[model samples]
Target chain A: MMKATVYVTIKQGVLDPQGVAVQGALHSMGFEEVSSLRIGKYMELQLDTNDRAEAEQRVKAMCEKLLANTVVEDYRYELEG
Target chain B: MMKATVYVTIKQGVLDPQGVAVQGALHSMGFEEVSSLRIGKYMELQLDTNDRAEAEQRVKAMCEKLLANTVVEDYRYELEG
Candidate 1:
């Protein structure tokens, strides 16, 4: 079996209102040391195949096809057993 | 300055409808090899402090107070320059 851990993050220069809101909340809660904050999505996938090459290709395809928005977000994945 | 990358994930046995929906979509899109799937949140935090220990404690406090719901989610963090 193979597992793919994917992280999908907004590209730089994109406006992240969610992050801003969280940061504001943190500041209100007294965490003034938090200078910046950004949020993203993380996914874990399990595949029935063990072929590293095939897993890589498939995981990449998955990211492009459904896991990420190529225009606004960047995705990277790590595959392991 | 210190950067903390935090990963927040649902605890095992929790009802993850979001993950299920995504898995279903993947299966329908012909990714039948996908045997399991889970989704979570990733956050990048920039701290203005140079103290690693202080940053670690503050980040942990942030996670507990605002970033994660301890009753249902598990969190881990890594700190770097």
Candidate 2:
């Protein structure tokens, strides 16, 4: 089996209201040391295959087609067996 | 300056409807090699301090207070200066 970990993050130039809100909340909760914050999605996947190359390719396809919106978000994945 | 990366994930045995939905979608999209899936949150935080220990402690507190739901989720973080 192959295990894949994927991270989907907003593009650098994109606005992240959720991150802003969290930063504001942290500041209000007295964590004034926080200067910048960004939130993203992390996913773990278990695959039935053993081939690393195939797993990587399939994972990339999955990220491109279903796991991430390529227009505004960027995705990267790591695969291990 | 310090950077912290945090990951917040649901506890084992918790039903993740969103993950289920994504798995289903992936299967329908022809990625039947997937066996299991879990989804979580990833956050990147920038702290204005240079002290590693202080940054770690504050990041932990931040996770406990707002990032992860103590009752249902688990959180872990890595810090770098």
Candidate 3:
């Protein structure tokens, strides 16, 4: 078996209202030291095969095809057993 | 500085189109043993202070406000140095 972890995040230049809101909440909660907050996504995938080369290729294809929005989001993954 | 990591994911029973698309890509890549795939978001925030209690509160605030879409997405976080 193989395991993979994928991370997806919006591009830095894009506006993130949710992140902003959280920052505001933090500040209101007496956490005035927080400056910047950005939010993104993480995923774990398990494959039934042990072939590392094939697993990597499939994992990349999965990220490009569905795990991430290529226009506004970027994705990277680490694969292991 | 205090660091917080936020993870956002669609709740169970909700449709995950991106995850489905990834499953397709994985199947095409010849690793047919894959069954289920779920995609989500990940974020890391660096607070300007080292106070753990305040930092946790702030981080949680961030998660509730803008780090996640509470209606459809679920969020969890971890704080570290």
Model 2 spans > 4 angstroms off:
none
Docking class of 2: high
Clashing pairs in 3: A18-B66, A22-B62, A40-B41, A40-B42, A41-B40, A41-B41, A41-B42, A42-B40, A42-B41
Q: Could you give candidate 3's per-residue lDDT for residues A1-81 as a string of tens digits? A: 888888888887988887788678767876677787777777878788888998898788877876679898888899988
Candidate 3 chain A weakest ten by summed lDDT: A22-31
Candidate 1 ranges beyond 4 A from true positions: none
Pairs of residues at least 3 apart in sequence or in different chains that clash in candidate 1: none
Q: How do all the candidates rank in terms of DockQ, highest first?
A: 2, 1, 3
Ranking of predictions according to TM-score? 1, 2, 3
Q: State the lDDT of candidate 3 residue by residue for B20-64, as single tens digits.
A: 887787678765778777888777788897889987876777678
Higher-ranked by DockQ: 2 or 3: 2
Write model 2 residue lDDT over A1-58, tens digit each, in one string.
9899999999999998999999999999999999999999999999999999889899
Docking class of 3: medium
DockQ of 1: 0.94
Compute the DockQ of candidate 3.
0.50
Relative to the unseen true structure, what is the C-alpha lDDT of residue A60 in candidate 3, on a scale of 0 to 100?
Answer: 87
Please give the DockQ score of every candidate, comma-separated. 0.94, 0.96, 0.50
Question: What is the DockQ (computed on Cα atoms) for candidate 2?
Answer: 0.96
